[model samples]
Target: MPTRPRSSSSARISSAIVVAATLVAVPPAALAQSGEVNVYTYREAKLVAPLFEAFTKDTGIKVNTISASSGLEQRIATEGANSPADVLLTVDIGRLKEAIDLGVAQPIKSDVLDKVVPAQYRDPNGLWYAASARARVVYASKARVAQNEITYEELADPKWKGRVCIRSGQNIYNNALFAAAVAHYGEAKAEEWLKGLKANLAQKPSGGDREVARDIAAGKCDIGVGNTYYWALMSEREPDKKAWAEATKVILPTFQGHGTHMNVSGVILAKNAPNKANGLKLIEWLVGEQAQKIYADMNFEYPIRSGVKPHAVIAAYGELAADPLPIATIADNKKKAATLVDKVGFDN
Candidate 1:
């Protein structure tokens, strides 16, 4: 992971922050206090700064965030009974499940969480709760593609040969989608579909989802797959990337007989949370309308709270009929999904 510049209000925990193989900045004493909550997150620091600032302003409790692109669960495990982390925040059901499977997360019994988050978007045992969601949708070049509708299975059609672009098939985002295919279509048909989709690749699978839109703008491909949030980020934040955003229209794709595939950015209560009370307070506040609004407006995600609307930018893509597949179902099949990706040589 590249080093992110530090924010004035929040410290960025980097390699230098570790001392004698232990994270030294956030000690258990500090975490146990009433004024602060410590968070170990896989989310980008910059993206979550505003929410933290707002949380502090709304309540007197301060938010101390440790950001890493990966390895958060392992770090907490290595810290053992002395870990100061109060909460774990991450994207994708795969990472959430990993935390539970690793025994680093404890089941949270919160009536607020149970009421605010939908059943399908949370763990049945309450180990994790999704704060927001993103759908995996198709990005089509506005000038070249005439149809507004498309299905995940259609990306494999022969007419789309050499015209589709995507990141690594082994990525968690893609893996979850592949897993969904398995849940809906069984292994044999899913593997056959994977082969067909790989045969249509415009280039070797590489780059992040935003690159799919960039390639579409450059006419490298006519259509590709990406998450809804990337398009919103490009359009709202990166001025130089506006052309790419303008080049394509987002089409919410569904499994042939099912609805759109969706994923989440979720929260978990650490097993060894030192500030358990403050941690619970923060988790409850996160699902409330005010925080959900921040998630929608600042992050371009669909809020998990019932009755909260998505930001206008996301709403423009049209309402999503998210596939009713439970996140746990998709997570359970992740290893099998990876196997199919390899069996079909998706990135080769």
Candidate 2:
């Protein structure tokens, strides 16, 4: 893991210190040309390190990573033609699109990516590809909510009023789900649905997905919408949070019969990637069965590859019949989605 460092305002403030903290260093021109890839990522260092290591072990190519919370797109833009970024690793389609919008990423034609990732999970132009997925699902009180099945529309039903606990509707996760709603139902009905769901809030929309589980366990609410992996994390990896998982059960909710709304952790190729070949190799490797298994087993995420299965811990949630809606279609509605979020004062 890269050590935390203070960031200076200027783009050249040495990325190693802040916006560009590198986990492993290979002098730009020398090692990059020989056998190394420079990666600028938004994912946590610990989460992606193993995959990088395995890639290195298998191919004998070096991996150097610069991890960040935000501004990677802008940073790459500032560096322009001189940028060493080979790949941009990020969690959401919105961020992936942002990199493209900033003109820092370029499209790549990869047969491996085209074959492994579904059409809905990648850019039609091949700009980015999702490596793994997670569904927006319900964590319902095991003791209170008896039925296993529920729909996204049902959250607005009067019976669930004053019972739903959720994070800020403005968060990217919820925005994606809400955007899916807008795409599925169109603007007018989507707004009405948001208003209804907001009216059913147990309290103000607040907290992360795990806290939603915590709140449900405390009986603060009867049900909450969260991602798939948090329940698995609580059940196995996080002993301290086991009671939260025990107090609730995962319910796969759909948009009517459209199937569960899903999101992804994805990657992009940098326009000025100095080690473009290595970067492409890494991207292709990520969707291969080996890297897919590492992602599934270690990250508790659903693999993007066709035949690979999710970690047993996550698979126990039940089959994730993901909605057929193109993720980009849902992401495209982000502006309208956020507008609806504020229009309804969902957080209030």
Candidate 3:
């Protein structure tokens, strides 16, 4: 973790500070004088800075951010009731469920959130709300694969033998996909599908999703599984990576009887939020049209709010027909998914 000086405008606290259990106190006068909110997030600081800055400009509420890649949930658990965290923002339903299960998040009753976000993407008790979504889809080599359509079950076909690429099966993104399989198919069949998918691996599962595209561009594989946003990012922002993006086409693969699998980047209210009112305000604003556009466009994600279109680069991939499998159902089967991954030796 990197260290930076704290200031009134923004502060980047290390995970070390969080684990050390040292509560950084805001001076009583500062707290009373300026309406502010403290956020601990797993989201990249650069990705969220613009949103926070916009919020401050509009509402005069100062935003303090603590960014880390992992261990945020545990750190909050360690801090107990004295935690200064007002909100927790993280990607993936698995992590959000972890926070909820760890008792770090409290239920929120926001009419704005309820109206803006679809029920399928949010917690039933309102412990968390998804702000944006990304589909888990197939990335097929443009030169080798001519078919525009594919299904998740088709990846197991022997015809694709030694031609599939994927990240580690234990990764939350893949885990959720597998969990969805469990939701649709029984565990026995989902496990069998895992073994078949593993047997089709071009190489031992490794690297991030972009690497899958890179491999496809390099002729290492004909098809790979990855999130939709990575292709959008590679095409628009990463000039050096554009070739990788150009080498493949996005294929929204569906379960045999269902729509495409989707995951989200979500937000939660802290159980002991000191500035509850302002935190709620921030949450409400995040789901609004303007803020939703900024938040989604920054990362090439689809805004969860109705009536907001995805960024043009993402829209080019066509609209996502997200599988209606409840996220909670997937989260519940996460452990079963992980166990099946190891059972199949997917990373080996």
Instruction: Go through the candidates in order and give the clash count of each.
Output: 0, 1, 0
Model 3 segments more than 4 A misplaced: 1-34
Per-residue alpha-carbon lDDT of model 1 for 1-348, expressed as tens digits? Answer: 113444443233433322111121465453377798898877776777777788889999888877766667877887888888999888888889889999999999999999888899999888999988999999999999999898999999999999999999998899999999999999999999999999999999999888999999999999999989999999989899988999999999989888999999999999999999888888899899998999999899999998889999999998799999999888889989999999888998
| lDDT of each residue in 220-314, candidate 3, tens digit only | 99999999988988998899999999999999889988899988888999888888888889888888888889966888888988888888888
RMSD of each: 4.2, 2.7, 4.4
State the weakest 10-residue window (summed lDDT) of model 1. Answer: 15-24
Candidate 3 lowest-lDDT run of ten: 15-24
TM-scores of all predicted structures:
0.93, 0.93, 0.91
Task: Output the TM-score of candidate 1.
Answer: 0.93
**What tens digits encode model 2's per-residue C-alpha lDDT throughout 32-135?**
56588888888778888899999999999988887876777777887788887899998777788788788887898998899889999998888899988989
**lDDT value for candidate 2?**
0.87
Model 2's TM-score against the true structure: 0.93
What number of backbone clashes does candidate 2 have, counting pairs of residues 3 or more apart or in separate chains? 1
Candidate ranking under TM-score, highest first, comes to 2, 1, 3
